[model samples]
Target chain A: MKNSIAALYLIVVAFNFSCGQDTANQVATISDTPFTPELLVEDVAIPWGIAFLPDGSMLITEKSGELILFKDGQKNTLSNVPEVYSRGQGGLLDVAVHPDYENNGWIYLSYASEEGEEKGGHTAFTRAKISDNSLTNSQLLYKGSPNTTKGQHFGSRIEFDDKGYVYLSIGERGARDDNPQDITRDGGKIYRFYDDGRIPEDNPFVGTEGAKTAIYSYGHRNPQGLIKNPKTGDIWDNEHGPKGGDEINIIKPGANYGWPVITYGVNYSGTPITDKTAMDGMEQPIHYWLPSIAPSGMAFITTDNYGADWNGSLLVGSLKFQYLELLKLNGTKVTDRIELIKGLGRVRDVVQGPDGLIYVGVEGKGVYKLVPKK
Target chain B: MKIFLTSYILAVIGLSLYFFQDPALEASMQRGNEIYADFCVTCHLEAGEGVVSTFPPLAKSDYLLQNRAASIRGVKFGQQAEIVVNGVTYNSAMPSPGLEDDEIADVMNYILNSWGNTSDKIVTVEEVEAIQK
Candidate 1:
C-alpha cells in the first residue's frame, strides 16, 4: 500500500509541473516617475472616453450616457446624444474624431444602444457632426446584433487609422464559450469599416460563408483599448482577462487571439480556464499582465513634451490599480513599465491631446492633464 | 450486535441534522458567490475590501449592516448619493448591475455572511422585489 501511494504522489507531482509550465509571460517591471496631474475638468462620473478636436477643445463621454464638450474652461453638456442602456458595464463608451476632422468635421461615438429587435443592449457605433453644442446629421454606422442582458464585457473603443478606416472593438458579451471562437457571432471581435457604414470589400471574412463580413480579427475576450500606432500605422489593443492574463496585442487581419481556448488566467472562482497559454494558430500578445491591472484605455506618446524618455512610449490606464502605466516599447515588445498618477481613482481613459499633453479620465472624479515635473 | 446498534443511532442523528439544516440559504450563498465574482468583484474586490476613497469596502461595512432598505435600493436602482461607509465618505456612483431580484438577494446574503460579517436573517427575493427605485 505504501509503494502504491508513493507512485500516485509521483504522478500528481508530474501533472502539476506540466500545468505550471504554461503560466503567464514575464511580468512588467514598475518604475517610479515624477509627474503631477492637473485638473482639467471636474465633477464628472465614469468618464469612459476622451477625444480632441482640431481647435484644442475636448469631448469626453461619461458612461451614464452624457457627452460633455469642454472648451475655453467651460463644460457644456451636448444635446442629441444617443441614449445608452447604462447598465453595469454598459453605457456610452468611446468617442473619437475623424482623422480629417478639419475638413470633414465628423466625430465617431460608440454606445450601448437598445435600438435593435433584442430586448437587451449591445455596442453601437455612430458618427455625427457637432453644431452649436448639439449633434447634427447623426448616422448609425454599425450595431452588434443579438443583444444580451449580461452586465459584463462590453468592449467598445473607437479608433481611426491613417487610411481613413474606422475600427471598433466589441466584447464577447459574457458568452465566452459561444461567441469568441465563432465567426458568425458579433462579439469578441475587432471590426473594420469605411468612414461611412460600408463594409470594405477586402475585409478578411467578406467572401467567407456565413462569417461576419466586418470582422477584422476574432477570438478576443474584451478589448477596451484600441489605438493606431502613429509610426507603424498598425492597430493595437489591450483587453481585460478573467482574473489574470490581461493582454496587449497588435491587430492583424483574420487573426485568432485565443480567449478561452488558451489563456494564462483562471476563473474568478480560482478555477483554471485552460492550461494552455500558447496554441498553434492563436496569436500571442506582446505583453500580458499576470495579476490583471484591468486595463481600459490606451494611447501612444508621439511628442517630446514629456522629454525623450516618454516620447515613443505607450500609455495605458489601469482601472484595478488606479494608475496610468507608461510602457516603453522596443519595436512591439514592452521593455519597461512605469506607473504614473497613482492612487487618484480608477483610471478609465487616457489620451494624447492636440496640445501634445496627456489627459487621463478617472471614475467618479473628472479629467486631469498629466504635466511632467521639471 | 453492539456495534450495529451504535451505528444505527449515529445514522439517525446524521439524517435529522441534515434535514433540519438551512439548505435554502446554503444553496443561495453558493449561487451568490458566482454572481459576486462576475459583477461585484471588479469594484468591491474578491474579499469585499474595496479601494480606498474610491470604491468602498463591503467587508464589515457599517453602512451595509445599518441601512438595509437603502442597501437593497442601491442594488435595485443605481446608487449616486453621498453615503458614509466605515466613517469614510464615498460619493462615487455605482451603476445598477441589472441582476434579477433573486440574484440580488443571493449576493446580499453572501456579502452579509462572508468576511467576518454575521447576519441572523437571510435576504429574500421578496425583500429585494419590495425595494423601490
Candidate 2:
C-alpha cells in the first residue's frame, strides 16, 4: 500500500493473516522479531490456565470454576469440577497434565476452595482422571492453610519436575510478613508432593517443630507463574511484588526466598515492607522489576517455530502493562528485554503449542496466537 | 400526519443526542466509560460481576441501585468500612480514586448503566461535590 512505516507494519500484519507474498520488503524491516498476533478463539471465560493434550486439543480453566476443552476451534465445558470460591483473585486456576499421561491419564487442577460458612477459602490442588471429557475419581492433593477473608494473592501454578514429583506454589494471602517467612504456615511456600497427594518425607520442613510437612521452599509473596525449564529441568517462578520488586527465581529445595523480611518492594501506601533487601540465609532473584509489571503466566519457548532467536526465550504475561514480555537469556543470565503484542490488553497466560505457535491468553480479549512473519 | 410528525421529532432528538451531547448526560456516560476502563477493571472486572464476596459485583447490583448516596460517597471518598452488596458483606477497603467530582459523576453514570444495569436517575456532578469523606 503506502510507503510509510506505520503502513509497512500493517502490510506485514496483512501477510500474517492472508499469506500475502509481499514479504521481501516487509521482512527486511520487521526489526528481526518478525512476528504478529492472530486470534485463535475467545470462547472461554477468564482463561487462567492452558495445557495441550497429546491430540492438540487444549484444556483451559476459567476463573469462574469451569473447564473447557478447545478442540478444532470449538470449546466445550467439561463436567464434574469442584465448586470454587471464585472470589477476589481466587477461582479455578492453573491446569497441568501428568508428564507420563499415556498411562496415568491424570489431569491436575488448582483452585480456591471455600473453607466453611465463614466466607473464607484457600487454594487447593486436585488430581482427577479425565474420561470422556469429565473428571472422575478426583483426589484432593493439597490445600493452603488458614483460609481468610482477605481475598487476594492466590498463587497456585503447577509444575512437574522430571522425577515425577509435583511442584506447586501458594501465595501469602496478603500476609506478606507473617505467612511468607514462617515454615509452619501453608501460605507463601512452594510444595513438593507425590502424585497421589502424599507429602514427601524428604521435604525441607518435615520432622521439624511447628512446620508444615509439605513445605519445600518458603518466603514468596504471591507467585503466579511456575514452570520447569525443559532444557535444564529447573523449577522457576515469577511473582507479583507489593508496589515494586516483582521477581523471577529458580526454586531450590529447603531454600528461603526472603519475602517481607527482605524485599525490594514497598507497600501500596509507599511505606517500606522491610528495610532490608538481603538477609543471612535467604536467596536472591535472578531478575526483578521496579514499579511492578503484575506478571501472571510464563513459559520458556523451546521450539524453533519462530527461528533460532526465539528458541528457549522466557515469555511472561504482564497484567499491568497489557503486553507480553520477552526476557532473553544467555545461559541463565538475562541479556535483553523486548515487548511484543503491544496494547492487546492484559496478557494472562503464554504457552508454546505442539505446533510451535505461541498461544497467549489475554484478559477480556481471550486466547490468541503469535506467529512469526513468513 | 400526526405519527409522521412524532417520528420526525424523535429522530431530531436522537440526532441531537448523537452529535451534540457535550456537558449533557450522554457526554457524561461517554467519559465515564473511559474512566472505568482506566481505573476499575482490574478488581471489579470488565463485566462488573466483581470478585465474589470481595469486590462486590456491580452488574445488576441491588446494593448500588438501592444505596445511591453510599455508592457515590464510596467512589468520591475512599471506603474502608464493611458494606453489603446482594446480602453479602464486604470489608475490603477501596482507596479513593482521586478523581474530581465531575469525573466521579461521569464514571458513576457509566457504571449505573453498564452490565445489566439501568438507572432512572442520573448521578449529577453537584451530588458528587457535596460528598465529604
Candidate 3:
C-alpha cells in the first residue's frame, strides 16, 4: 500500500506540473508610466469622444450631451451644451477643435437632434466659439438624414485632415438595407465639409442631385472609429457589423463600401449574411474582426514613445474585449496586433497628448496615461 | 516519516483552499448586477425575461441552460435574426454589446441562477473564448 501511494503521488505531481497555466496573461498590475490608465476624470457618465484642444487641454463629449474640459488632471464641466436628443446612439457625440482654432476659436460638435414630426432624430454638426467658458455663436454646420424610429446607429465621429477639412462619419442608423441603395441618404456615409459646415465644391458627390454634396464616401454601417494618418494623410475607420463582422477600413474619397450586401459576418443566430465579402464598386476593409470586438475609439501612433516597433501603429480601444489593441500598420495594411491592457474595463478612446504621453479613457475607470516606467 | 507526511497533507490542503475556490466571484457578481441594471435591463428586461417577439427571453432559456457555447457566442456577437426559444420564434436585432468575457460569464452565471434556471457549471472566461467559434 505504501508503494501504491507513492506511485499515485508521482502521477498526481506529474499531472499538476503539466497542467499548471500562467496567469500573467489574465491580470496585470496597472503601470504608472510607460502607460498607466489611472482615473484622471471621475463621475462622468459614458464619456465617448475626446478631442485635444490647442493648449494641451482636452474637450470630451459625454453621451448625455455634456462637454467637459480636462486640464492639469482636473475637470471643468462646461454648461449650456445644447439640449441633445439623448436617446440610443443619439446625444452629443464628437467634439473637435478647428485646425485654425488658435486664431478662429471655432469648436465644432456633433449631436443628434429632433427633426420634424414623424422623423425621430438626425445627427447635426454645429460650430461655436468658446468664450468665457460658455458656447457662443452656436450655428448649425451640417444635419444628417432624418426620420428613423430605432435610436441606434448614429456613427458620429469627427476628425480634421491635414488639409484642414473636417470629416464626419454617419451611421446607417440601423437602416441596413437602405445603405447600399441610396447615396442621397446621409446614413452609412462619410461627409466632408468646410469649416463653415458647407459642402466643398470639389467633393466626390458634389454634382449628384438628391445626394448630399458633402458626402465623401458611402456604404458603411455605423463607423465609430475614425482617425487621420498623420504621416500619409490617409483616413481610416472601424464599424460595427450585424452579427460578427466588425470591420476596419481605409477611408477613400468617393468610395462605395459594401454594407448589408457584402460582409464577412453572419447573422447572430449563425445565419449567413452574404457570401460575397467584396463586390464591384464597393471598397473592402483593410482588416476585420470575426467575433466583433466592438471597437470604439482609434488613434494613430505618430510618436516614438512606445519604441520604434509601435511608431506609425494604430492603437484601437476595444470595448467588448476590454483591452487596448495595438495595430502595427505597414503602408495601408495592419501587419500585427498586440493587446496591451487586459482585464481593464471598456476602453472608450485613445489619444496621443502634447506631453508625448499616450492617454486612454475607460468607461468607468477614468483616463490613464501610458509612459515608460522608470 | 509520520511528521513529514502530516506536513505534506496540510500543505496540500492549504494550497487547494488557495487555488480551487474562487475569491472573485462575489465581487464580480456584484459588479455584474450593477452593469446589468445600466446596460442590459432595457432589452433583457428587469427580470431577465427579454421582450417577447423582439428580444428572446433569457428566462429559463434552453439556449441559456443547455447550450453554453451558443449563449456566450450570442452575446459576444449580436443576434440579429429569428431565433426560436421554447418553441417560440423571435425575430429582432441586438447590437453586439460591449462587455468583457469575465463580465459576460458573471452575468451568464447570474442569469442561469436567478431566472428560474439552475446549473451547477460555472461559466468561466476561458469557456467564453472557447465558444467564440
Candidate 4:
C-alpha cells in the first residue's frame, strides 16, 4: 500500500509539472542568417529609439535624454529638445517621423516628462518640427496624469497608421492593480489622437462618462513595442509581463487586454498572479513569450532586402536575452519564432530604414545596420 | 528533581532565544521581498544571481557585502560607475529605482539577508535617507 501511494504521488507531481509547462505558448530557437551586422553609429548608451529622416539621415534617442541627428557621417546633438525626467526606466523613449514628413515636416517624440504638478514623472508624447538641428514649434500631444516616482513600466512607443492617426502607449507605472483595469486613469493604456494631438470624435470612449476619451485600448501591462503593419495597417504591440508573460497583442479599440485579472505570468517571486489565463471579456494575446525575452523594439520587414522569405516577418528586439527575434506570421498568427543576431548587447530597438535595410539599437553600444552579404 | 527542573528551564530558554527574531525586521523583510519581486527581480533575477557580465549577482555578493553605504546609495540614486563584483567588472548602468526611503531600507534588509547571505545589522530608513547622490 505504501509503495502504491508513493507511485501515485510521483505521478501527480509529474502531471502538475507538465501542466505548468503547457501554458508557455511557443519557444524560439536560434538559426543562422545571411546578414551580418555593421556598426553604423557608435557610443550610444541605452539607445532607446531610432527614426530615419527623409534625407537619409537618422534620429536616435538616448535614454539619458540626448537626441542625436546622424547626417553626413557625423553625429550632431540636437538642441531645443524638451527636458526629460531621466529616472529609472523613464527618459526619452521613442521617436518617429510623421508619415508625410516631406509635406508637414513634423516629427513626434515620446518621453518621460515631469511637466504637471505631480512630484515625479509620467509618459508624455509631443510633436515638433526639426530645422537647423533644433526642434521648433514643439507641441505636447498627450501627458499621462498623476505622475509617479516608481521607476518601472513607462510604455512610450509612437506609431502612425495609414489614416494618419497617432498612437501612444503608456505603461502602468508599476501600479498594476489600479491603473490597468481603470479607464479613468492614464497608464496601462494606448491612446489614439489626430496628427495635431486632438482626440478623435469617433474614438471608442468619446461619449462614455468619466472616460479619458483618448484611450484606444486599456488593460495593458507595459507595451514598449508598437508598430503599424504596413501590409494591413493594423496596429500591434508587445508588452513586458511580470515574470513569464511577455505578450504580443494586436491592438483593437476599446478592447480589454486582461492584465492583473488573467495572466500567463506570475510575480517575479514565482508566485501566481492569477489562476485563469482566459476570461470572457479579456482578449487573448496573439503571441506571448514564456520566461520573457523582455521584448523591446519592433518592426516588420516590408522589403526584400534580405530575401523574399524575410519579407513580412516581424522582428522584435530582446532586452533580456540580447538578441533579435523573428516571428514568422501568417495572417495575424505567429506560426514560428526564430532567433537572429544572437549575442549582441541587449537589443533595445529595431527599425527598418527607408533604404530597405534593418537597423538595431543596443544598450551601452551604438546602432548597427544589418547588411546583407553580397 | 531540583537539578532536572533547572536543566529543563535552561533548555527551554535557549531554544526560545534561538528561535526568536525581531518581529519588526521580519515584517520589513517580508515587504522588501515583495518590492524585490516587482522591481529588482527583472535584472537581478529571482535568485539574486544577476546576468553574467551584464548585471552583477547579489547572491553572496562581495561588492554588496563590502560596500554597504555605496550599495544604499546605488539603490537610492542610480548606479552608473564601473564596479567589480566577485572579481568581475560590471559597467552597466542601473537606473534609480525611485523607491522611497523606507522601501529602500526594507529591500536592502531583504537582499542583505537572502540568498545565502547573513547580516547582523538591520538597514533603517534613516540610513537610506542619509545616503546622498
Give me the candidate number with maximum DockQ.
1
User: What would the per-residue lDDT of candidate 2 be over residues B10-121, giving only the tens digit for each residue?
Assistant: 9999999768755577788898887776467656767888867657899999989898899999887667677788889876556555566888899899999888897878
Error of 4 at A199 (Å): 0.7
The candidates' DockQ values read 0.45, 0.04, 0.03, 0.40
lDDT of 4: 0.90
Candidate 4 local lDDT, A171-244, one digit each (tens):
99999989999999989999999999999999999999999999999999999999999988999999998888
Model 2: per-residue lDDT, tens digit, A55-110? 88888888878898889888888999988875557889999988888788889999
Best-performing candidate as measured by lDDT:
4
Q: Which stretches of candidate 3 lie over 4 Å from their true place?
A: A1-34, B1-133
Which TM-score values does chain B get in all models?
0.83, 0.80, 0.74, 0.87
Runs in model 2 deviating more than 4 A are A1-32, A116-118, B1-133
lDDT of each: 0.89, 0.81, 0.75, 0.90
- Segments of candidate 1 deviating more than 4 angstroms: A1-34, B1-34, B46-62, B80-93, B99-103, B113-118, B122-126, B129-133
lDDT of 1 at A62: 91
Clashes in model 4: which pairs?
Answer: none
**Candidate achieving higher lDDT, 1 or 2:** 1
**Candidate 1 on A1-374: residue-level lDDT in tens?**
99999999999978965654442333344454555689889988889999999999999999888999999999999999998987668999999999899999999999888888878888899999999999999999999988887778889899989887999999998899999899999999999999997999999999899999999999999999999999999999999988878999999999999998998788876788899999999999998886789999999999888888779999999988788888888899777777777778889999999888899999878999988778
Number of the candidate with higher TM-score, 3 or 4: 4
CA shift at B82, candidate 1, in angstroms? 6.7
lDDT of 3 by residue, A1-374 (tens): 99999999999968954543223112223343255456667765566877777888988887767789887878887877777776556778888788888898988888887755655677888889887678999998888766664566788788889886889988887667875447877788888988788778899987788877888988888888888888878888888776557889988888988888898777654668788888888888887775567788888877777676668888878776668888776787766666777756667788777666777877655666675554
